[model samples]
Target chain A: MTAVASGGRVGDGSVAMLRQMIRIRRFEERCVELYSRGDIRGFLHLAIGEEACAVGVTEALDTDDAVVATYREHGHALARGLSMGAVMAELEGKVEGCSRGRGGSMHLFDAPTRFYGGNAIVAGGLPLAVGLALADRMNGRERVTACFFGDGAVAEGEFHECLNLASLWHLPVLFCCENNLYAMGTALRLTESETDLSLKAASYRIPSWEVDGMDVRAVREAAARAVEAIRSGGGPHFLEMRTYRFRAHSMYDPDRYRQKDEIESWKQHDPIPTLSEALLAEGVLTAADLVSMEEAVDAEVDDAVSFAESGTIEPVEDLERFVTTPAPADADGGRRS
Target chain B: MTTVTFRDALREALREALRSDDRVFLMGEDVGRYGGCYAVSLGLLEEFGPERIRDTPLSESAFVGAGIGAALGGMRPIVEIMTVNFSLLALDQIVNNAASLLYMSGGQFNVPLVIRMTTGAGRQLGAQHSHSLEGWYAHIPGLRILTPATHADARGMLRPALADPDPVLIFEHGSLYNVRGELDDHAGPVDLDHAAVRRPGRDVTLIAYGGTLRVALEAADRLSGAGVEAEVVDLRTLRPLDTATLLDSVARTHRAVVVDEGWRSGSISAEISARITEEAFYDLDAPVGRVCSAEVPMPYARHLEEAALPRAEDVIAAVGRLGGCGGSDG
Candidate 1:
């Protein structure tokens, strides 16, 4: 409900936005540390710098709308209101985590939050979102399926096919492209000669938009309008959230793709602090309040680490479970998102 | 109660599934006004309408991917490929997306989709159109492969598959679509995990599926003439292979012969033979053998086509090789 061009305002909503963003920032920063300490295994893809896109887009949706995120989806999961304890416990591979620790960080899932998955395959969630939208349409529901994929996913044939079908059928699908400059190591420019992703969707006759992903408010506003369109049977819409990932694509990258100065240049427009500064200038909350809020988030993340530490490991016997739904269809371990 | 060909059984299954569930729909090339390429979906478009009986573009990957999406979205989608050869174009969606979604998502998503494709050669359709890739799909986890050899299975497997929470591939032999038989009862809900004994015997176990089942049964009759009572086992499902039935019969018979239309080298028959050896080698008096199609692209000539597909003669010869286990007694 608050209107700020990118991170230029400190309205009543600023503190909430800052808190969510900081919570994700602290959670993933600790994740990177824990991953190094061997507390986590497998590929840990942290959404360190792209917190604005998750928080902003999620802020625009309701509780019932569906969300399908990518591997680098910790921020999205956190912003969607999946308990920090559950997300942290998932990363810790505990049975009590969102997907019962079956989904590692790259595969976080919480069905209750309507976050469909933390799909590891690039562009895999697009078709799934289209399917969810199809279900919604058939059920005569007004829910929109916001599918989050990286700019790299645009190159995948699934993306093209899904967008075409969604547009042709007038399905309520919001194709959210998180253009974080690079696709793992291959930069966006390398994949498409025309690096503008929204244009690609437009090429498919789908409605498209571009937003400053560095600014949470801009992302939120753009997402709100697009989602509103989709919810009202406006068919499908595409948004290119031009953001950046400060960390390596995953834990494996050596930061060989972009220069530090470029990172520093983008860091100037970091949504968390920039919005806090504007909020301070607007007299909504003082610098003390921002610090205290961040401190609270830090403490909350610390509690998350404690919860993850105390979380119980799934028994080895259940390892063969969930691969198939087994004899009973409903008996499949239903997600607790 | 109804005498139906394999094609009508499939059509009946489609009609029943589409009528029974609001979420179940049929989609593929020529599945609409044309009454389907093989007529397995005949009268379905007229009954279910164009929306539910979707006609897709020539793009196999796109439509198949869309079907997977629809399945994930909570719809029971039965996508037909017209023939097994065309499925290669949609392999990315089937093998990659539909098959891997469950495991990759850490069991968060289950793709409840059914893909039906006409398979095998004998109609002089040539090398490009004739293939039996059930073995390749069997190699992939997360998918259930069903090769129905009877009217009951063709009618029965669809309901359970529509209810199952994962992808299931049904490979129907194009050559057997016209094979009709007297039906006593409709199979209500069949298990996708085991095999069925179509014609029981005692001497040698004749194991086969899809296009090869008829040959196995014919061979069993031929063996009966020679006093060799060959038991026939139809492997309705291939993935969680009903090795239990295949080996159990082999253990009793003291010999086994697998008949598969797929090529022998690394075929499903090869795998079944290795499994029989591993599980029931001690129970056998002779080594297990296979009556698989000759390793070729299935030549276009009618005689060549006949040579490429495993036949009753091949099964009889394989059964003849089990001389130690009563074949010599005959």
Candidate 2:
């Protein structure tokens, strides 16, 4: 793990991180193609330039650690080990999807991976994360609940309430604010009176810091430290990841909010190529290795698309199935229906 | 049977829930040190300690959403909102998260949370505190809405509500806390999915719940005095409404009058009236009548507040308008 933090080994771990980022980048790129083809519908929020934060922060979490993410969470879900097939199937509205097709792009959920949701509401997941951490603390479990929300969520009242409650109770929560500059076309500067997002968490007495979100290593180091501190009973910690979104807020967004030149400027710091170049400079991965990784991701993305294309739509007879549990109390370990 | 006030029965239910399950915990404002706003959780804090009987800050959205999260995390949480008015602050959590999670997540998550709030107007607490918003909550599909109008139900409903895997909202009428009655000694977890025929008759049906159940009962007595045999139906559950029992009563009575503390426009009472006309239109001898709160903010003046809320006399008057007072079918 220190290799990940101290840049000691640009070995399998480093290559794996870059590979994960590339996988997400390629998967969402395919999603864009699919969206244009009418194979995927609903609001699709791509994590194009923001892959580093998802990869680095999620890698710091333990297997049992819980994650609650925002709508722009295809990268987070992928980095957390949710199957590409399931995510794609969910995007395709197939029953084989992660949430059984109930939640499409904005609500991807994986119970086995401990991914709570892809919450579309700006700050809705914050309180849920606080409660999850409260559960861990009360149950004598040393697990961190990492909550990922955008800068837009900072303006929501739940953000203030959740931060205060988490700090007040000494709950183990990693408050990761993905400061992607704009919140659904509303720039952070225009909406917030004081734009220093870390101060919001500081107001609740929680220790906070900032990380260059475009740099995977910075995000990993900060998240690792925060997760370690929380697991050691240090209560909640906050990290404001300074990042940017190269894509529109959603598929329907024309992205007229920013200049095209600004996107190209941010593209110079793209996490995928930047990390790839770092790995190449360290002699951890050859140019051939990078080509092979991209090709592998391409094959994987194709398989996922095929899986999604062939996936079945949940029958209308089961329309009301998951709304309430269908299992009888006697059939399923006293689980109420 | 043990005689107790509505407050004591609720306290006993909380005590039982805590004693029975290790995973069960209660959290809200003033629930611990302040012994709850209306004394429903008076001594439970000392009994269960601060861990189980959590006294939260006035952060309703966080606490309530935490309740949903805790339920998702495999803990049973009973979140107390001081009253229905304050619950508006946490409405997003309730409506968006608690109510929608299970359905939206394709059934991977079900919020096994119970939110209890005092509702309805009678104490003249003014426009802010006095309003029946339970009808608003009942409109959501995933939530189970309960309104216990009896001491037995007050003592028993919490258990089954806790046993439920979905989010259940229990609206405790603020005005009924001091109302005393005998809770059956054998009372246990009661069904949270049905209505009860409190007083059975054949001339007309008076449907009411929560704070207005007593009003409907009194109106039935008044109708009996005037030679009209009126049946009284106590709708214990507002959502997944017990349409069967209501239709049965309506079928027998042939006339219906709905009494509600919420405003008449788009209220749960309006839903019931429409349902009766839709499901049992042929059985009705006249148009369904309603005695609902006036569509005005509840005022602080006692007279104005009383006028704004539904009263037994109002129920009688509404029934009288249905031509049921003379013991002869119209």
Candidate 3:
């Protein structure tokens, strides 16, 4: 299905995708500055050139649908409508954080939004997605669960195991594989014997496809179709989103594995400018409109940083809380340690 | 009192759970048509239908992780992984996600999931199939490890486990499935937070659980015959150990002997010995004795397997050593 718009709603939707991408771009650019200043600690994995995949795919999901994301999930979290302040505070490890200062950048979780986690383990969230969809199916609910993982995860055993379970059980799950060429330092070609990820899913009898991850409209259209099929009892669907990550895998990496020329070349196809230029050509956005969007996103990100800075540290005494839900009154008495 | 086999008690518990709550479901390989590897889930599929007593492929990690997810989605899921040996394949999901999610998510999520797996070495299932690793699970922080040692507990622990907000692992000793006993008709949710005295006495405490509970009781019987009056303590809950009950028993008896099927090094028996030393050290009349399985991958031969495990004689020997009989390890 083509994303080309003919009416007011379609035109507005296209502009919204552009705005979401701009928001992610500005928010993460600010994260880099905050990380260097030590305001944000721990491993920070950015989706600098992967704005379209997160925005487009998340936009396709209904509010009732659940999302299971990987550690490089700031883009996915923001696009899923998690408050910018909470996401920023989580990164800053404050009491106002999404995980209450417990899970720094790698584990931003919000129960209200149905964002399952900000999982750190490779391929960890796929099985969780299958289970979430299983819950929906068992309860006779028609909600879909979107599971995001990287190309590197294909080698992990859970990737294959979860795929088979989802299909065998016919659960409503959309497996979105962000094929960003490399897993940390190892290139996909060097790792996967069959680099075609869609073929892997198809082997399990799930309808799978390849999507242009750099194009927001293309991704949105593909995700919409897959999610529609899932909701209509089509079981699980897989999308091999061919995308690229412009930043180093994490802040610690010098990223000497790939050539600087290769990075610069991928930057030429960066999703933000590509979508913005398309909008400008379509008269959906003017130079003045673009400037205002950038200014608005920058100010919003600035406010998030300030919110994170002013947030409180969790009291040290409450450290052991939540280890086990404090036992109920009728629970086995006097044995709790 | 009602007579029931351990296997039937487990099935009854599962049936009650499925009937009482729409959210409770059982999922695992061969759990439906094949009636479970141990036949504990027999007839559940037909009663609850395929949606509730769901069968899964041989993928352990996926099904177990799905149980965690289903629990998070407000459904109480009971996932059975054929045996403890098979559970190793899904260790990542169990250790990384199910056990850590609540704490890592800062309490935003709680996995009200029950994972039942057959544990202990017996019946010549050999090295791959037979092993007791429940103690390894007991080391985890966020999980509640339970070993249902009697017919009442076999029928009672599931409801409490399902009601528990955190992840609870029920390790049913494979050998006890055929053991028949009297279960009270009024039996309901059993308290899983404390150890219970199976047979009370004042001489010495015989500590064990699951398969080893029989051995401890038998040793207690032999000790009573010898006019020793040994008390038997069945540890139902492994994690969040009831040191209060344990110390009370030790304080009264003035001696303790821990019997476990798991090997000795860093085993649950070792933890008990350490606890008694820390809490009731002065109350102990001798060094705490341990009757753990000989440190060997369980052999297939019947006699060797029997020898490899902690038998009633081993518990008797440990007790005798506490009474100054000739022994080294104990």
Each candidate structure's TM-score, on Cα atoms with residue i matched to residue i, is: 0.93, 0.97, 0.96
Worst-scoring 10-residue span by lDDT in model 1 chain B: B321-330
Q: Which tens-of-lDDT digit does each residue in A1-337 have in candidate 2?
A: 2333345444437678899999999999999999999999999999899999999999899999999999999999999999999999999999999998889999999888889999988899999999998888889999999999999999999999999999999999999999999988988899999999998789899999999999998899899999999999899999999999999989999888999998999999999889888877777777988998899999999999999999999887677676655557433222222
What residue runs in model 3 are displaced by over 4 Å at the alpha carbon? A1-10, A328-337, B324-330
Which residue pairs in candidate 1 collide? A10-A279, A110-A337, A112-A337, A113-A337
Cα deviation at A235, candidate 2, in Å, is 0.4
Candidate 1 on B247-320: residue-level lDDT in tens? 77887788888888888888888888899888888989888888877888889888888877788888888777
Candidate 3 residue lDDT tens string, A177-256? 99999999999999999999999999999999999999988999999999999999999999989999999999999998
Candidate order (TM-score): 2, 3, 1
User: If ranked by lDDT, best first, what sequence of candidates would result?
Assistant: 2, 3, 1
**Which 10-residue window in model 2 chain A sums to the lowest lDDT?**
A328-337
Q: What is the interface RMSD of candidate 3, in Å?
A: 1.1
Candidate 1: segments with Cα more than 4 A from true spot: A1-12, A328-337, B59-62, B100-108, B185-193, B327-330
Error of 1 at A218 (Å): 0.5
Error of 2 at A46 (Å): 0.8
How many angstroms is residue A145 displaced in model 1 relative to the true structure, after the best TM-score fit? Answer: 0.3
Model 2: per-residue Cα lDDT at residue B229: 87
